[model samples]
Target: MKALLGLFILMQIFIATNAQRVCGTEIYTQKLFAANPVIKNAWNNAEVQIASTTKAATGFAARDTAANEIIYIPLVIHIVYNKVIENISDAQIQSQLAALNNDYSYSNIDKINIPAAFASLAADTRIRFCLAQIDPQGKKTSGIVRKYTVKDYFSPEDGMKISAQGGDEAWDSKRYLNIWVCNMASRTLGYSSLPGGLANVDGVVIAYDVFGSGEHVRAPFNKGRTATHEIGHWLGLKHIWGDAICGTDLVEDTPTQQYYNYGSPTFPHVTNCSPNSNGDMFMNFMDFTNDGCMNMFTIGQKQRMRALFAKGNLRNSFLLSFACDSTLAQGSALPAVDTIAVLSNKPLPQNTGLKVYPNPTQAGVNIEYIGTLNNISKTVSIFNVVGNCVYTGKLTKEKAYVNMANLSKGIYIIQIKEGSNRLTAKIIKE
Candidate 1:
């Protein structure tokens, strides 16, 4: 019995050590590029824009002190499972969310383990995430969709993303960060669509066993950093080794290195292309290092991520995604595609100069808009504490009025959406 136990222990170690982090992002993107062809050029343009907009040509895209604020991303997790064990619990989902928040905000307790040489370079991305409070139909939701599939496993480039193929179709990609957790085929742990990929298939996919930070989760990949890493790819962050020998990841603070690093490499793990004693940034979240070994994203990476969310950038549409707030959901069904179409129509969210008045009042309220809202129909919808749309009307000229005398004395969300532009404020009806 003792010999059998020792053999099991050795087997566990062997499996752990032999397992490599296989991210299908590069191959997936290459196939996508081949299919669309034009997407490659458009993606290149987006990269050039990111490079041009980086702050001050600094080694790191230092936080925008003047305008830097926490950006909250709303997520919708599609769990496509073939077996009962593959359907992860809500606790596991929440655990992954917590881990993402910590790592992105640079609040991870493991930061202390980052090498002193690169510790100071880690930046607080000021990015946070939450499950969607509203579904694409504008109804209340837990933000998690569980669908059973007949297939035992899905390939990195398989029909796992399409509902017709037994997988759940993605919700509106513009308003929510859709993440699919399923059993990936082969040794691939996950893959993600880059910024310019097809909208219908835009998302990140992770293998079920490596998703959450929980005891049920397998080791090494179990810390929930797989999402963090794949999301980096979704947000336009390249692998630390740039997917090539001594390649560039487009981030300056990160040292140039030859190929990717596996397992926990020692400090100053110099590569053939190492420029200095401080070698490859094998500990970066973008590297293929074990989840426990990866701890931080350099300031340069934070900048690259931020560049996509800047004004008129690729990811700026997320700013108007009120799906994170439950109270904004519609009482009736509204197809997600229509809402997303409106979201995609705008050039960029412009300052609408919108205002809501008569707070804590006995009578009605006045919503005023003083910007380019003439041709575009700006509709105002009011909702109570619950996610029920109480009243809906159109904004005429520059202002619209809604009678609230019958409304109970309480707070309400006054929301106005015109194309992708949205104006929202809280008002009291007394």
Candidate 2:
């Protein structure tokens, strides 16, 4: 009777601790794999290939070290908010970007806290993200899609990925990273569709309050690591604990962990499966630690992430995605005939708002074409302070980048003309 009671108590401990940091990714993927066994077969085969190819074999071309050029992913953040606070501010959204860049680039200052044992394994993934300047239809966009959702909470089965279900639809997952920030049901901080999952549901879903590092965001999770963790899964990384007891995450440098770690575990937190005195690498982004506790991705994990982008692999399509460079999105949208340019002298519509960012730009400037100016085809002309047209580009409802790297440092005027409507904004190139 005592043994039976002890077993019940142990099971309760497992159940209670498991609820601390809930991520639906593993559960979601397992359901997907069960529904379609072919997917599981394909994933297992791909893992074998990835392991061998990324193993630093002599004479083999490694995906990560190839030229060492950074990979920039274009993102379209879909904000589905039912409440005012759920509709996070742009500053909060921006804070998530800053956190991701710092984490992936190894530029974050908190990295200094990593234990000396695992510090040598830390890696700069060479991956970066940007709000997509050009959208799927070749239109100007702020790369932000905000829609009021009647459904206050979404489940992991992906009601959030379908517009018919009161959630915003995903963009072309092959070309742009679709991030849906909303209120998640079941206390799920976040979840993601893995590389081999259906494209329509491919991407990350972050709960609003835990999505960014901005003020008033939840403690222990406000540092934007939820997005980072889910995005890591989207990029083909498994949890450091491998979602199982004494399991393998498939990365060599990351020591095998008995199970997920929660809160802040003291250094040298040993487990039965630990390979050395170094113990578990709970600081890995793939672990279930709090946002501030998680800090690095190992070199082995970097290899796994970069492998998805190899030629003919699942994410190879991103290599050709020019969504990051809006200059290449020429005439991606059509304007209503009534909104055609009447004349450059036409008065500016009161509803039209023009916003340019990083005004004193060293190179690229993002011009967001929104409000009444959205979708209407317009001519974008850049003139020097002396009024000479030095550069010209096409503009529509979509946001695009105006390359000023080649132009001499000075003040410039950006003019957009559509029918009798004209909007002009001044920007300085530093």
Which prediction has the highest lDDT against the true structure? 1
Model 2 scores what on Cα lDDT? 0.76
Which residue pairs in candidate 1 have backbone atoms (N, alpha carbon, C) closer than 3 angstroms, thus clashing?
Answer: none
lDDT of 2 by residue, 1-430 (tens): 5455345334434564433667888778878987989988888887876776567422255544355668889988887766546766667878898899999988878899899999999999999998887878776555776665667698878887897998888899999999998888866888999887788988999988887795757878878899999999998999888766787888888999887788988898998889888899888999988888999999888878887887767788888888888786654322111121112234423333555666677896776643544624777777775456788877754876778899999877666666544445666788
TM-score of each candidate structure, all chains considered together: 0.72, 0.73
Q: What is candidate 1's local distance difference test score? A: 0.77
Candidate 1: where are CA atoms >4 Å away? 1-18, 55-66, 331-430
Score each candidate by Cα lDDT.
0.77, 0.76
Q: Per-residue lDDT tens digits of candidate 1, residues 201-300?
A: 8999999998889797888788899999999999899999876667788888899988778888999898679988888888999998899999999888
